[model samples]
Target: MTHGGGGALYLLLILILVSIPVTLIWLFHGQGNARKRRAIGFSQIAIFAIAIILFFSGVSYLQNIGFVAGFIVLIAMLITPVVFKNRV
Candidate 1:
């Protein structure tokens, strides 16, 4: 892939799309407790930060795609808390 604006956008889109499902699974089905949730959340934030960097670095790096996917997954991760919070 080329390191141009279009490629960067493509990578971003792909990453966000992929992350959604993974986030949902982790949020809903992962084992552990609140601590685990906190850990996962922090880890995901770190991962996302890295991904953003990678996404911008170039268009061909594996992390570009991975990070985008992770971001998508993170949306789900973020939502779960709000969803449950309203109920509880």
Candidate 2:
């Protein structure tokens, strides 16, 4: 009946997953935005989704890779809009 930090980590991932779309809508909203920019904006959602799927799967190496990838995607999420903003 005692679960340690698993629930907390799950919540963290859920927060991250939710933040991606929120950030996309908030940061990228404007007239004359390009489809390419929108694609880049939404890629974080796909990245985190795959990361979570891989992280939870049975393959140990994939889980580690996914864990690392998730963090990398988090950083990219912060940086991506800035990088792509000039094109919008």
Candidate 3:
């Protein structure tokens, strides 16, 4: 059971890390459409933000919760703009 839990925690960490680049691309590319892109960006941000909050709070709710998930979410938030930056 403990091993399964550890594996879950690790998988979650990897998912979070992968989400970083995906979310950033989603936000940036979504911007081209303005209304559509902005909405997509906002939703992506909200999802990541909530994920981060939940990840941290999960530490109290469940032992062995990984912090890497939250860190990756944070990185996604930071990279969103760079990926979305206007290009000529």
For this target, which candidate reaches the highest TM-score against the unseen true structure?
2
lDDT of 3: 0.58
Prediction 1 TM-score vs. true? 0.42
Stretches off by above 4 angstroms in model 2 are 1-22, 26-32
Which wins on lDDT, candidate 1 or candidate 2?
Answer: 2
lDDT (CA) per prediction: 0.59, 0.69, 0.58
Residue 86 displacement (Å), model 1:
11
Q: What are the TM-scores, per candidate, against the unseen true structure?
A: 0.42, 0.66, 0.48
Residue range with the least summed lDDT across 10 consecutive positions in model 1: 79-88
Ranking by lDDT: 2, 1, 3
lDDT score for residue 32 of model 2: 50
Query: For each candidate, how many residue pairs have backbone atoms clashing (under 3 Å)?
Result: 8, 0, 2
Per-residue lDDT over 27-53 for candidate 3, one digit per residue giving the tens place of the 0 to 100 score: 555445666656656776676666556
Alpha-carbon error at 17 in model 3, in Å?
Answer: 1.9
Clashing pairs in 3: 28-84, 30-37
Q: Count clashing residue pairs in model 2.
A: 0
Write out the backbone clash pairs for model 1: 15-68, 15-69, 16-68, 19-69, 19-72, 19-73, 20-72, 20-73
